[model samples]
Target: MKKPTLRLRLLRSFLVILTPLVLFLYYENYYAIKIVREEVSQSTSNVLSIHITQIDRTLDEITHYLLQQIVTSDTKSAYLDMASLPETNGNYTLAKIKIHNELTSGSTAFENFHSFFAYSVKKEDFIFSRSSFTDTNDLKEMLGEYVREKVKGQSFSDWIVLRYWEKSYLVRVAQASDGVYIGAVLLLEDLIRPLRGLDYGDRWEAILLDTTGQPLTKSVMSPETMTAVNRKLVTNPLAFQVFENPADHKDYLLVSTDFKQAPLRLAAMIPEKSLLQRLPFFQGVIYLIPLGVIVIFIFYSHYLRKMLFSPMNSLIMGMRRVVKGDMEIGLKEAETEELNFLITTFNHMVSQISHLKINVYEEMLKAQQSEFKHLQAQINPHFYLNSLNIINSLSTLGENDLIKKMTEHLADYFRFITRSHRDTITIDEEVRHIRNYLEIQMLRFPEKITYNIDLPEPFSRTMILPLMIQPFVENAVIHGMEEGSKPFHIEISAGNCQEDPNCLEILIRDNGVGFTPEVLSTFNQKKFGDGTGTHMGIWNVYRRMRMAFGYQAEVTFLLGEPNGAIVRLTIPAIGAFHEMEEEEDGKADDR
Candidate 1:
């Protein structure tokens, strides 16, 4: 399976974290709404109870006033006089006038009472105050109708709420004497006046309803809401209830309380929306909930991207570059300590790798240069002995000119060899030294040894390790002479390598015996030590070339045609002038 991208991984991680958080927020919001609703219901119920208490107190006052009127000495005396009087007597008229005066005075003291009346069964007459708002006949007719409908079978002093004309009234019927009935009319509005002081908001309404669920006073609720409430009250007529309005589908909280002194239920209806609006804190929580979630998500994404994803992506890219051999690339500092530590460690590792590469290259160059110097030192003694033998033979021949010239060449060759401090020399210098050694050999065997040196001017100034090519030339001369019957002819040539312009190619060919199969196999295997001294010069040269220039230099020994040994070598064409300049700078630095 393919690995997920960084963006996909981050998204997955965010989802894994966000899913549970969203669920938690949802549950928290649900619980908060529930709690708010419960609190609203409870608060609304308390308000309702306050209004009910006020209504109850007002009714109690009204009841007290009516009771006071009933037991008063004036009212009792009026009832007794009306009972004792004859129908045609003038005292009966005076007694009825006194009763009327007493009822009028009592009604005047109470602001709620619209009127007062007394009925005498013995006189078969209705007596009431002339100060009453309605005609005496109308009042008597309303009282008679109210008694027949709601008060006939009820006990004396029972209060009934009834409508007279188009207005509602609270009336209590009482037996003032053995045959007398007294009733007082109090307006329903007067009973409900205490509720008017309440501060229910615009979306809330308070209403007075009778035991039959009939509204006794005007209500702010729409007709549809009232209908729903009435229907709900039939089955679940709780003191407090919350239900949705069928007409608008808005929730409403209802709180109801019964008046102890009256057959009325006081109910407060408030929209659930209004209750929530009333609490500014709750409204803020509701509005801020979604905003808070969005804000949290935004901040969290940015934090993860900046502190986690971005740094990790950079580190991964840096590692990829490192794998591709780009040690120069580096990661920037990170904000978090852990990431910073990783960046620091990676940078240090790259630095160490770069340093280690340089150290290894330098060490290899030193080892190769040391080996070349040691091998060159060993070859010097053998060449010196051969040159001495050739000079001794030349002296014995008594050819003065030849002896003087050969002596001069031998001195030059030895002088070049003794300059052990010089690890490298120009191609021109090496060629001159090789020519000097070959000339000495030619003097020893004048006709048997012949040579040609074909070095171009362009390659003359190229620098190489001293004795690198001379060893191969010496080897060709020594090994080829063993099998050749004809005069040994050596050809030395130099040119720029065709494949690599920076490298110089040198070819040495001699008409003589070539390398044996075992020697060639050892060279191919790059095994330097062959135990025999004959292969040492070639092996040393090959090893030095490999170590000093590495893969840049190439050396091969092969048989030329059918009768000669051939040696070819290539080395980097480092200019002598540049090397000399570097040496001068090094010396200046040392000084």
Candidate 2:
């Protein structure tokens, strides 16, 4: 599967986390508003109910007192009903005093009770009890000018909204025995004045509504708003009202309760905005949560892309160039600390790899130069001249068979020398080349030179460096030859070493003059034993062995047991051509 980019991954994770947070904030806002609305409405309703109950109780008391004044303990007609009293009836003045005394005591009995009036419609007589907050002049003027005519036309016996001296009053009227009316007047403003100081909120209206949802007194709201509220209260009839006021384009909540003793409802109406104004600070936080999240998301995505995704994209691009072998590429330093560290490490790695390639190339050049030297050293023109001399002598003697044999051996020696440029030659072919070289020597020395070669048939396929054995053989012939009576003998044998089976052990024994101690020491030190540089070739072969088969490829020059020199050699196993085949495979991989 294809992988997602770093930006996509980080954004996906950010959304996964942010989605829940937004949802949670939205839910919290909804829940908080829901709870606050309920509590506010319920609390307003409860407060309204308390005030309404108290006002209802006061109205009940005034109503009962008015009814009591119209009847005696014996259920006879009351004083206000005596409209046609006789001139000799002294009870008339006493009755007026008694009525005034009863009205006075009743007016001061409870809060906002202004007057208790007893009026005789037949006699056109009126009486009132005045309190400190009441204006008796307004009442006397109302009695003389308005109440006399207003009561004469009012048909219902209930609470009436009456005006006196530009102020409204709640007048409760009760008829007693014939045309006598007993009534109580309450200052409408003072009756429900305490409700205005309620701790509901700023800019609320306290209203006393009749059963028909009509306002009985002045209120903060316009008549238009009141009409709409009254319509909802009458039609839908909820415990609370949710009304939008058209006059001010505001929403309001109306919490009201009915008065048990009167046809009125005491309501507290507050604007929706004002209602929430008193809410705790968390309510405002609930509204701001979504806005805060939006701001955070915008900045979060920007920084994440800038600090993380952009740098990661650069790093990925740099890696692609590196993979495609662009070692010259480089990345800019990142502002973020962790990404900067990664970029620095990548640059160092690329530098180290470039340096390693250079070192490897130099090593390969050295190996090729060494091989060229080996090729040059193998071509000995003097050996060819000597072989030609032997053949010429044989031909002069007219020995046709000996001349043919010498010419064939010399030709084989020249052929092997021409092919010395090859890195490796088969063990069997090398041994054959050695036989040709020895045969040429035997032809020159006749019976004075003799040699034997011993190599197992299974070891014939073992590959070794070209000219590896020939230089040592030439050393034995060149340095060990002596002018002696005994025929010079040389033997070459190879087998597995007793020390390590993974190695090859070879012994070359020659019954000829061996090396001196000085020559042996100089050869071990990789120096020419003679001033003529003859031993350098042997050292080159030894160095090549060490290169091909490591330091374990040992060559030791020892004095022979009785007369000759012994050349003991140990090398990494040449039992098969496995090592050469592996090297060729490695070269193929490089290509």
Candidate 3:
């Protein structure tokens, strides 16, 4: 069996010995920290809870006072056509003033108070203000419509905002009897001040968020933390939740409680750092106990080094040699039984690897030789056919245009065969070469074929494997259309495929004798059937496609209806074709 790795052996030894010792230390530290954090959290939660509850009670009292004042105030009837009152009306108003004074003074939990305008179906307008000469009508009109909406049936809503003097207030509406509405604002900062005063010197902070989860106010370390807390509350709105910063992985705890009498959300945030601060100083001593473990590790490491590390070094060196192609080398022998067995297995592995290399090399050589022979056979036949046409053209050409076109075709064909430096050419250059070949053939069989090339203007700069379309054209001429007075019309159009924007599609269509069902099947199979003659051009083009682009870029031959054949080739055009086309264009321009 193979020997265990050095890391595994070290880990096993550590787990058997050091793990329990370290684990005990970890548990002690973890639990101790956890206990302190929980205690601080629970204590702060309780104190903050009590203070917030009192604030809620105070807000309820404010609502009750508003309700009582609107009900008792008889200014509406006294201003009417018939005005009368009991004789003790002055004392009654004085007593009402006393009660208002007591409620305002008792509301030390709030920064300021203002009663919103009361609108009633029975009473036309009822407004009050503490300022003697203040115009309460404009503010009352603003509250009037909202009061009407609230009394009509919609629940009154609350909003909180931090105002002057670093105080935050919750402003909301409440309904009294008989279609009357009162809007009051309560300050939570004063309420939370008592909770802050109960801090036990642990760097803790207390904050309050109204039920809407907007940050009413905070005493955290930074404003960024406050923003993060607000964002978290809005994202995940569970009442009591703890979240960690997704970017930094720091934990933050949030606890929210509902006020029984008001539509208020009281949320408190305590950061993980604040919780960790509550641990006692004595726990630091317990964490430092692991320092004594150094002596035991040193004695143990010395004995394991000779037995484990030395054998591991030999194994590592042997692996490096194998990776670097010296597969015959094997590990050195060691006295340890595990190391002995490892070396023996390594020798067997080396032998198997050496045999594998020979087999792979032999198979590759066979493939390469076959490819070479196939290339040789394919190139010669194409050359012979083109050379025969050129010779025939030279022998019988009369006009200057005919000779010039023939020479261009002959030159282009030879240039393509001789150009060994590049396997690809620009789409414009490929089209030009095809034009030259067609121009030459047009002279010999002037009435045999007519062809048109259609490609997007921008795509003329894209690249394609050279001679990709040439062979297909040659096949259409030779196999599909032999001769006619009305020449076979061939149209070649290139564009981006509709489905895949990254791919380019080339369609070569010819009005000629289409393929039989058998021929179509043979083309699809891409093989010779029953020893019948095969077009070397089509086969060679297919082989080149497989070699260059694997299976993604392929050529398909389809027999069109009546008397036509369509050859479509789709190739990746975004990066591969565009870059190569530009490079080829640069080279051509330089030439």
Candidate 4:
């Protein structure tokens, strides 16, 4: 065989190179398109994931808030009042105060809430009102069926009709007390408004539903789609499920998240089309640049190998030397002086970061000390007041039933303060604390003032702050009634509020004197002008409640029936809070 010529050899070599280059171009395009598609898919998924997360978060927030209110006895009383309920309408006086506080403290969402009410177990009436939304009749009938099916301790949500407005609301209900259902109603507009504010496009509308798939908002959704989604949720109510979008016949992602240790369910959805939109754009860009298409590739390769590659190797070695505590390592000067400066800067940055860490540690210690001092200061006044009350009792009257009750009240009050373990407690404990304090006052003026306790049964353990009821009672006994010839009657009662939850109704009436508008105005002031000795307890109670439970807990004074003044203490209740209720029952049995 004849040997091939040099020209033929060069042609053969070129053909060998060309074949691989052609194959590389084709494979690069194919893989580039595939990567772009995957990236687009991932991006869309992430966007939808965020949207769904937000929706879920909103539902959680609404459910958390409503559940908190319904579980409370005060709010429960207010709800019963709203539906024209008479069971505890007298106790609904405090509902306004609780609602005002809730709005002020940002616990509730809507500003112009009309009422809160619940349906009775018999479904004969719908009890509700504008604030602390509660109901009796509707709640009784509708929730009766739910309690029998759902766990006794569990909470659930649904859409409820409001009488004052044309809209509906997302109402969450729980068993607050026997024969009484506590619930909170959030305007549907408010719940979905935040979602509408979200940048989710028209193709991505959120739908809030009960476990049975009933629409909680007025958002227009196809009936068939709603039914299908509800069926799917009912089948596996606790899990997340994604399905084809019924409106556009496109794939959509759906997910559900159960709020940990909270009575809330969140679900979200994202369309698949949104994710794949950018795939083509990325595909075009990746294929437009080919590494081997340049004529200067071989020349550039030489420079990279000779100058860039060797210098980078030395730089990396310098880094290793520095890592090994050899910071004095020197580098050969290169055309890129910036690289040398970068290495020097890295060493300096490490030193600065170390110094910053030490400074931060010292600052943290100082901050912790300051916080400790502040905490001590906060507790001092309360401690002093408690000590003073104790001394006053022991010195004046030793070891009597009245003193015993007073001491117990003081102890219970302090116990609540020390237990600063929780933001709220059962209404029952709070009421008992209130009654104990009143009993002490009764001992002081045994024949002067008459006290009556009229709380509904089983309202003891509904969640409330311990001293929430005492401040109002103190205000009534100390300020509203005078020591004169006329007798002073202080009535304390817990009843179901028509539209809110349970309300602790307290009316302190005196024939001696009634309060004028000036006294009322002065009392409403956030800070009492003369803190020297006046309104300290009242002010402390007011400020602490605002801080602890937000504006939802407050002390209010009004003209009382048959003369004197009526001071109402309204607090939020937890439906599941039965601890105080049982304790109250035990107290009654003892009596």
Which one wins on TM-score?
A: 2
Report the C-alpha lDDT of model 4 over 1-591, residue by residue, as the tens digit: 999754456456765876687677678776875565456545544654565466456556555666666656766555545434444555444543454455345433534332344434433343454323344444444445654545445545453333233444444565443444545555555644655565534565565554445555655658876666666666765443456767667775455543332233444555545544546554554455344434344565566656565666776786777667564555666666675676556657656655776788799868754643443345446544754675586567664655566666667767656655344556566666666666666667767777777666666445654455665666566566765666677776765555575443333344435568888787766555533456656665565555544566656667765677766655555443355546655665776
Choose 1 or 2, whichever is better by lDDT: 1
* Local distance difference test, candidate 3: 0.65
lDDT by residue for model 1 (355-398), tens: 89789989987886677777667666766776677778878988
User: Candidate 2 lDDT, tens digit per residue, 1-591?
Assistant: 999876788778988998898888778777887788878877787787887778888888888777777666522333632555642467666666677787887677888667877667667666777744347666656654544575667654667666665477777877665656667878777878888878766678888877677777787777788887877777777778677777888778877777776666776678777777777676778767778877988999889878887888888988898888787867888889999999999888888877887898799879766765654464355346546777887778787877788788777766766644446666677678678777767766678888999999867777777666766776788778898767888898888888788887778899888878987776566574432354566666676677667777878888897878888878887444566656755765776
What would the TM-score be for candidate 4 when compared with the true structure?
Answer: 0.31
- Misplaced by over 4 Å in model 1 are 1-47, 50-73, 80-93, 104-113, 120-140, 148-157, 177-179, 272-278, 317-333, 340-591
**Model 2 spans with C-alpha error above 4 angstroms:** 1-5, 74-81, 86-90, 131-157, 160-168, 291-307, 317-327, 332-591
1-591: candidate 3 lDDT, tens digit per residue: 999876677868876888787778778778877776666667666766776677777667766655555455553222221112232577534433444454344345444344333334344444343333343454454455555655666776443342434555455665544444445644566556666676444544566665555556666446666667677777876654566655356675666666666555666655666656535463665646566566667766776777777787888888888889998675778779988888788878888989999999999878965774565456546755775766566577555677676766777667665653455767787788778777776776777778999978988877777677888887787777845476777888999899999888999999888788888887878774322246667777677666667777877779886678999898887677667657766886787
Report lDDT (Cα) of residue 528, candidate 2.
Answer: 46
Q: Indicate whether candidate 1 or candidate 4 has the larger lDDT.
A: 1
lDDT of 1: 0.75
Model 2, 378: alpha-carbon shift in Å?
36
Pairs that clash in candidate 3 = 211-265
TM-score of 1: 0.49
Better of 3 and 4 by TM-score: 3
Q: Give the 10-residue window scoring lowest on summed lDDT in candidate 1.
A: 145-154
